[model samples]
Target chain A: MTQIVRTPHEGPRAASAKRPGRSAVSRRSVTLITGCVLSGMILLLALVSLFWTPYAPDDTSGGRLTGPGAGHLLGTDKLGRDLFTQLMTGSRIAVEAGLGSVLIAAVAGVTLGVLAAFAQGWLDDTLSAFLDILIAFPTLLLAMLIVAARSATLGSAVLAIGLAQSAVVARVVRILVKRVLAQDYITAARTSGTSWPRIVAGHVLPNIWPTLVVNLALQFGLAVLAEAGLSYLGLGAPPPNASWGRMLQEAQATFTTAPAGALAPGVLLVLLVIGVNLVADGLRDTLDPATGRRRS
Target chain B: MTLLDIRGLTIRTTDGHTLVDDLSLTIAGGERRGLIGESGSGKSLTTLAVLGLLPDGMTATGSIELAGTQIVGAREKHLTRVRGTDAAIVFQEPLTALDPLMRVGRQIAEPLARRRGLKGAELQRAVARALEQVRLPEPDRIARAFPHEISGGQRQRVALAMALACEPKLLIADEPTTALDVSVQADMLDLIDTLVRERDMAVLFVSHDLAVVARVTDRVLVMKDGRAVEEGDVREIVRRPREEYTAALVASARRLESALDTRRAR
Candidate 1:
């Protein structure tokens, strides 16, 4: 009678093959669909903007403060730059920043976490202590420091956000890897002559990825917001790159004359974040190993 | 022809509390030896030590020579090389012993692919055969299903199949039927008996129950409080136990047996 306090999600919790059907299932799908539609809208715009915006984002091709018209579908800003094009391009950047930072975090964090989990006494202690200290440091401030060190550009903002968020990812990964290592199957795998790398690849990674994917998805929204915040502080990719945060900041002065200037980018940013969060929630429902929905 | 030989095997916690005292065991090629002890008597730890898989912070001293490989103080690299091909284990709880996330077929295919270099169509056939050997009906569906999707009996069968995939020299079953129902337990024992006999493999069957051990093994080693109390032929130990601890174990087993017999007769 070894005291193996297995994680609740594992074990005989859902031993029966009862189909999970309820209001909760239907509701999650609803949110999932809505999130997809919202997030898809931004992704579609970003893709389309790659080839075509209403006008060049830097073009002063319309009258200042002009209302939405056939010529400029959204309008023009104080600098007479096409607002529609700016917002479209801004989305591309938003998506880029979100995706970039998330990718970075997933890669760096999972690596550090796996290493720390496998590390022996002194190494494990050192890695864990370092991660804890990083966790205490604010992600945005770390990003800002990276921005300050390098020239204020898109690459630096992305690198900063990604590197800063990796610590959180790594810490979570360490706990997850350790939990997996404690399972009886892990011992079984070892006894079966599964090499360390094979066990990690087969047992460790497969057991952990469902939770990791969802975690990375949620971090996507935060990365988006963090990128925008950087842009607002004039620390994002330079103008014409016109990240939505920069749009919001520039629109701050012209709220009375043309509320759409601030309103458009602000609205898109909120919608995007909401969409990503909802999608993350939807993913959690979908990818949950407990519900046994992720088997295939 | 000795497949497993242990001398002065001792396990201690990092804090210096001894869990398993000086114990010795020897299993010849194709021999079946039963290690009987109640929980905390170090039966399971002995099995783990045989596989060189002692838990972290706990230390094992003294010699454990399995297939001529020294287990005590051996590096993980060398130990891993001896594992599976030399000896494989089926844990007490099949539900947790299995990777719940993996399909049954793939899990069985692991040792086969690793040890025998099976792949693709050949590997699939081997997996199905392993499932079939375990007497799992609908090997196709069961193979595709997850551990939780199958019944507890089927999961244990799958675990046995995985252990036997490469047909190792020895099989260590640590309370293999402890978590199983009585009828299923009988069937699993019968299955293990038939399969191991077919393969001519040695078995280290660890259990707390005398009746369970007697069913599958010829020899039994009675352990109490981390020390070997008595060791003899299974029937001899059960029929006329030597030590007080062993007598208690036999008495309890007899009580359970007659309890069942009376209920059946009545």
Candidate 2:
């Protein structure tokens, strides 16, 4: 057997040389790096807030309406609470909501999507119609209703946002799965005597994962924004917990007098959302077959 | 010993459009047969019916026996067992016939593991041996590479290795070299012919190209519009085609070959 196995010198070298275009690789890498850095900074802020803060987030000892000065990093809010501590804690809340909701959306959406793609005739049509109906209902409004009904807490907000986002994820997943199913390789796998479940595990899921990763990253940003909206409306995370949306709502009245109070949470919220969007953009560039590097 | 026996195999859609109309053929053990027809001539449908892989809403009627086992209307569970073990099919487009994301070795190993229960060192050795049998270079490296990592000819070879891995009694090559270049196509045809001879496997080679069908197959079946118009020895049919359809096909193929030869001479 060893003697029979020939070494073809020309083939492998030619194959390996077929790398992705230079411009495409560089562009994707730049996007991926920028996204990573921005998201990493937000995550770092959240992690740091977990251990320590500049001052007690709820403490009202600092002078009310003071500017940025010694002992006070971002000055104080109208109620004299440490502005920096509140902003840092708000970062943690944003991350939690983003991750939790995205998790929920992924699991439920992927299952429903796969089922719809595999189903035939009426069942497929019905699943697609149901998802369409869900998508038609506005995400924020749906989250608001769920939060109102369930008593707004971190868990409820996460659940509400996740359920609202699942429809969009499901739709994308269904389309991706349907496209993959139509490929010749799937037919080949079927002819190879591989069972449906095994084919899905071995072929279907792996092919669709890159697209799903990119879509889910975009959903993460959407999830964060939705959670913040709910928090601003006083239907997310409650008062005791520092949420960026709630901080923004609280700083609205004192906006003219103390600019930093409104600016601190607002700036951090914008940065985190931008960070997530950049990550999604980078992921799309990296995972897309047309843009990404190929083994050949 | 007849390896496959099909009698009155008619395939039709739910809307009652007949795709394969009462087609019947037989292949004995170690026999090599060619199914020659144009696109939409039901050559693929007939082969797919044998493997119980007809598309949704298409129903296959009449008897399809493989080693005396009924295949038409067989349950999916039983058909799956018969499929990579009793008979295996190598499709036309090597580019798409393989899972792009999966390593070639694991793709080949999957059926072997499922059909033969081979695992660990035994599985690895079996996959390497299969690759070697197809005359692919560096079996270990090729096995580790993804489908897109190899050239078209190499990919087709991998596909052959996968089909032959189970050492099935019957091998169905459904226009397996049609998607390859002219030079590579001959090499693939030679590989299939040599492998079939070595394994003593009954082959049902389907192709629209008369030249390719003639090169590998000993017996030929000429099909047109879902019907078998003629069947005879490969040489006899090519030399003196009985049916008008087969004669036309032979004439066209000859014309094309002669035209190519003239161009080469120029």
Candidate 3:
């Protein structure tokens, strides 16, 4: 019996000769590297804080407004808490809430989005109506409402933010799924004797993953900013616990007396948010097909 | 005796637009029948309906039988067995027909795995043999290469290999060569014709190109307005076409060839 097969070529034969030095760098590389360094530093701080801190971030010092010195590197806050320790400890709250909220939102959104695209009748109508309702409210206000209604804890704040942001993620997923569903490969897959489960798992999911990854990264940065706003407004995870927003709240009163106390945590918060946004932008550039290999 | 039969096959979109209407055709064992028509003449739609592959929102009502088994309007699960096991289609635009992300060899192996329960070494051996039959260079390498990396001609051959993989009794080629360059189109047609003759398989070769229909088919059905207006032996239909539309199509094809001849002479 004769058999049918296709010959495969190894290592991109088309890239021969004229293509030189594949390590060409892009501006995105710089952005990505800088963002990665900032993110890694924050994560390292979180890990270290779980075990120890140089001084208690909430402890009062013997005197007021101690300038930078060996014992107090970033000086001290109004309560005489070590500025360096408070910033380091605050890393846990920022990273966890931002990462956790976006992850939850992505899971809920991607599932609903794919379902809305595939189920075109009453199911589509119902899901889309619910999505519209979610989108109608400002995400921060919705998060605030949820947090206000319940005890404002870290878990509740993250859950509220995730639920509030899910509508945007779902909308993006739905549009992408609709595009994939229209492809000829999908039509061919249906006629090729492949079952729906295999089609969705193998074909649909892989095609949508790049889009989902970029969306998740972007939403994480947004969540970080949103979490900070909540903390500043006193609706964030309540403390003796350190958060950049709660630190900012404390800084507002001491802005006139010791500016460095207000400025230190505020600078760190901006740096973290900038780092996240830069990473998201880099990921979008790299993952997008149109601009993927332009540097090379 | 006929191995596959279609009688009074009609399809209409949900918007009440008729795509294929009262179209009937048949293929006996080892027959090579061509469905020749202009675009929108329902040749492709007729085959899609028979295979239970019309897009969602389109409704098909027809009696279709394959090797003594009825298949028209069968639920998707039942149709799955029939698609690659009993009947397979080689679509137009080979680039789009095969999955872009999958390796060519693995795609050929899929039907065998799904329909016949073949796997592992047996599956690999079957895939290697299928690639060899399609005349692809370095069958092992082609199996690993993605669809986009290969040339258009190679992709069409891969599609042919896939259609022949399951040893299906009936193969449908829907404008299989419409997307290829002229020289490559001739090669693909020859490959398909050779396979149909060797396997003794019934083929529903659909195309808008009358010359292709003439070259590859033993019998021809000329469709217009979703219905077959002329059906006869390929040579008879070409030389003494009964319908006006069939005659016009043949005349236009001859004119096209003459124009090409003039351009080549220059």
In angstroms, the error of model 3 at B105 is 4.4
User: Could you give candidate 2's per-residue lDDT for residues B50-91 as a string of tens digits?
Assistant: 989888889999999998789987898888778777898999
Deviation (Å) of A256 in candidate 3: 4.4
Question: Which run of 10 residues does model 1 chain A get worst, by summed lDDT?
Answer: A1-10
Candidate 2 chain A, poorest ten consecutive residues by summed lDDT? A1-10
Residue B196 in candidate 3, Cα distance off native in Å: 2.6
List DockQ, one per candidate, in order: 0.42, 0.51, 0.37
Identify the candidate with maximal DockQ.
2
Can you write out model 1's per-residue Cα lDDT over B75-178, one digit (the tens) per residue?
98998888888999999999999997898889988888988998999999999999888777778888898787777888898999988887899999999999
TM-score of 2: 0.94
How many clashing pairs in candidate 1? 0
B1-266: candidate 3 lDDT, tens digit per residue:
89779888888899999888888888998899999889989988887776688888998887888776677768888887677767878889888877765788888887778867888999998998998787777788888877766778888888888888889888989999898877677767777888888889988999998899888889999999898899999999889988899999999999999999999999
Residues A81-182 of candidate 3 have per-residue lDDT tens digits of 887788887888888889889988988998888888888789899999999899888766876788778877777778878987888899888998888777
Deviation from native of the Cα of residue A44 in model 1, angstroms: 0.6
Model 2: residues >4 Å from true position, as ranges? Answer: A1-10, A284-296, B263-266
lDDT of 2: 0.87
Clashes of each: 0, 0, 13
* Tens-digit lDDT string for candidate 1 (A80-169): 888989999999999999999999999999999999999999999999999999888887788778877888889899998898789999
